[model samples]
Target: MSEFLRSRRARLRPRDVGLPEYGGRRRVPGLRREELAQLAGVSVAYYIRLEQGRGRNVSSAVLDAIATALRLTSAERDHLMHLARPVSRRLRPVARPQRVRPALQQLIDTMENVPAYVIGRRLDIIGWNRLARALLGDFAALPPEHRNLAWQVFLDPSARALYEDWDAKAADVVGYLRRDAGRNPHDPDMASLIGELSLGSPEFRRLWAAHDVQDKGFGGKVLHHPLAGRLVLAYETLTLPADPDQQVITYHAEPGSPSAAALRLLASGQEKTTERTLSCSEA
Candidate 1:
């Protein structure tokens, strides 16, 4: 909790929050503890206690005030709540590999035109459909460790060229990972993944240390496929009720759009899947 607060505080500058800045070679990144206390309307000592994780049962009103001072987004605000009031038992489930159900496989197979794949807790691609292979590349082709979404974002050479707004996409992935880390602090695999990424990618290290949080959900992406050209797909992320750690991400192009045409072309000559799984609509 303290680390999250400290990192969040470090990312802010006094001038960003309308506080006057005294130019100097300051060691800390953002507003000082005293400056933040003034902005949040709390005693410096109390705010310090909060930052140090010494406060018990912190009031929602106080947290709200601090959140306002920090200018947190809805996702960041949720992460703050998680860090501030985490349950011991649910902090991290035992590290087990996530799997896709038969019904889920059917669903992916049914959505012939949609590029969809199931991701596990640490963003590992557990399952992918034909269109997903066409769109996201063959996750099965990558080594087990490199099969992770976040890992690929930093390690994969072609990923940067695939996304028009690569930095923004990478930042969002980091934010999602940060949120997951807060929620599942003790997951060993997640911890190892973070350590590896921090050591391997300087950009990942910088973003991870910043303590940004984001809820991964419905979104749109513009991807440039080598064979299919540019595609504008509206994406939706759906969670499986039975397994909360698993998420099915599916992308669809608008009807009659160029993206739709591209999908049609990509699906052409692809094997006709006779079986289908339960889809997002059924869920």
Candidate 2:
């Protein structure tokens, strides 16, 4: 939380927030603590305590004031709230694996031309359809421990080659992880994942430290698939209301576009491969 606050503070300039610039050389790059306190209408000492991660019983109003002073987006403000008041003190490692409801799974499976997958807590890929496996690598082939978006994005060489803008995709994954970390501060699984990624990828380490928070609810991605070739897909992330921790992300190509045609071809090939495997098993 302290690091998050400091990073957000470091990103702002005095002039950017309408603060008069002083002539003498300033020691810090962004708004000083006192300046931020003044903007938030809080005492310097109190804001100091909050920034230092020592303030307890912090009120929402004060957080809102600080968020406004920092010009945080809605997603960022929500992250700040989570940091201030974590969801769990020490979340026990979930014993059972996350499962997608049968109905939900069926719905996605029927979308032959769309690539869709479900991600649970820690951004782990829990369920995916045939097209999703074809577009994005085979999630079933990966070990359960490594069936994670962040894990694949950072550690998998194929992901680097798959994403047209690897850096942007990596940053989004880190930001989402950071937000989840704030909500579940003592999640052992999350901590383990972070530690592993930090050791494995320097880029992940750098982006994790940046403290950028966002909810990527909708976005577009350009992927270079080995079989489908270059594809531009727009994705929508929908949170499951029944299971808020789980989200379904579905990717679609523009209608009548080359990417859409590629999706059809991939779906057809996927269907044929599945049928062949089923026949072989039966025989």
lDDT for each candidate structure: 0.85, 0.92
Residue ranges of candidate 1 with Cα displaced over 4 Å: 10-29, 39-41, 89-96, 272-283
Model 2: per-residue Cα lDDT over 1-283, one tens digit each: 8988999999998899999977577787788899999999999999999999999989999999999999999889999998898755445555456899999999999999899999998999999999999999999998999999999999999999999999999999998998888777877899999999999999999999899987979999999999889999999999998888899999999999999999999999999999999999999
Q: Estimate each model's TM-score.
A: 0.83, 0.96
Residue-wise C-alpha lDDT for candidate 1, range 64-98, written one tens digit per residue: 89888988888888888878887676654466657
RMSD in angstroms between candidate 1 and the native structure over all alpha carbons? 5.6
Best prediction by lDDT: 2
Error of 1 at 172 (Å): 1.2
Best by TM-score: 2
lDDT of 2 at 239: 97
Clashing pairs in 2: none
Residue-level error in angstroms, candidate 1, position 68: 3.0
Evaluated at residue 234, the lDDT of candidate 1 is 90
